[model samples]
Target: MPTKVKPPPAVTFAHPSEAEIARLLDFYGVRWEYEPRQFPLEWAEDGRPTKHFTPDFYLPDFDLYIEITTLKSSLANRKNRKLRRLRELYPDIQIKLLNARDVEALFTKYGRRGEEMNATKAEK
Candidate 1:
């Protein structure tokens, strides 16, 4: 009988833009991982995590985390609050928040608009 081999875990992107960013990172030879770790921003009295924050990308080479948010005003406000809390709790961890405008700027630089960016295959 042949030994069964387990397949490697598939990398899933929560949004189309994440896939676009992955392509760019691959092109630049900048190794990156998607949501490699989640930091607990709030804990309950039982020591369980009540609130957590996860950055979109983690660049091993840069030793930093990049959070991409394309949410509207209200959602962005909430995201910003979480980021602030994450920073406060984990001061040593380096992370950056890339808002929609920043991502748009990047798209413009690559001559790939938002529509084209969404053309890339993404999970969820």
Candidate 2:
């Protein structure tokens, strides 16, 4: 008798930055999924869902969720707030946010410039 194993699902990216991250992860031999699951962060007083969040990537090998933000815009701030609430609600979930500076550092560590990945989408 043999056990059944499921194949990895195809990863899709809604933004160019996310595609770049997938490439970087692949280069490092790390498997990653894009917005694989949504986490509920808030519920209404009547038990209705008020808010939910889906992180950018899930690195199963490391058991971590990676959220990338190339800008300091209000949307990013909102996402940050959601992440905070998510953390408070699910303290056991492993997650990290990779802001512009962190992304630059990651590229530099691999002898690549963050700017090389199209400054149009990257942070200034």
Model 1: per-residue lDDT, tens digit, 61-122?
A: 98999998885888788989999999899998999888878887887788865445456534
Which ten contiguous residues of candidate 2 have the minimum total lDDT?
Answer: 112-121
Candidate 2: Cα lDDT at 41: 79
Task: List the candidate 2 regions with Cα displacement exceeding 4 Å.
Answer: 1-11, 113-124
After the best TM-score superposition of candidate 2, give how far the Cα of residue 77 lies from its true spot, in angstroms. Answer: 1.8
Give the winner by TM-score: 1
lDDT of 1 at 70: 84
**Residue clash pairs of candidate 2:** none
C-alpha TM-score for every candidate: 0.80, 0.76
Estimate every model's Cα lDDT from 0 to 1: 0.83, 0.81
Q: Compose the digit string of candidate 2's lDDT tens values, residues 12-44.
A: 667777777776776567888888899987789
Q: Note the clash tally of each candidate.
A: 0, 0
Checking candidate 1 for backbone clashes, the offending pairs are none
Our model 2 lands, by Cα RMSD against the true structure, at 7.0
Q: Candidate 1, which ten residues in sequence have the lowest lDDT sum?
A: 115-124
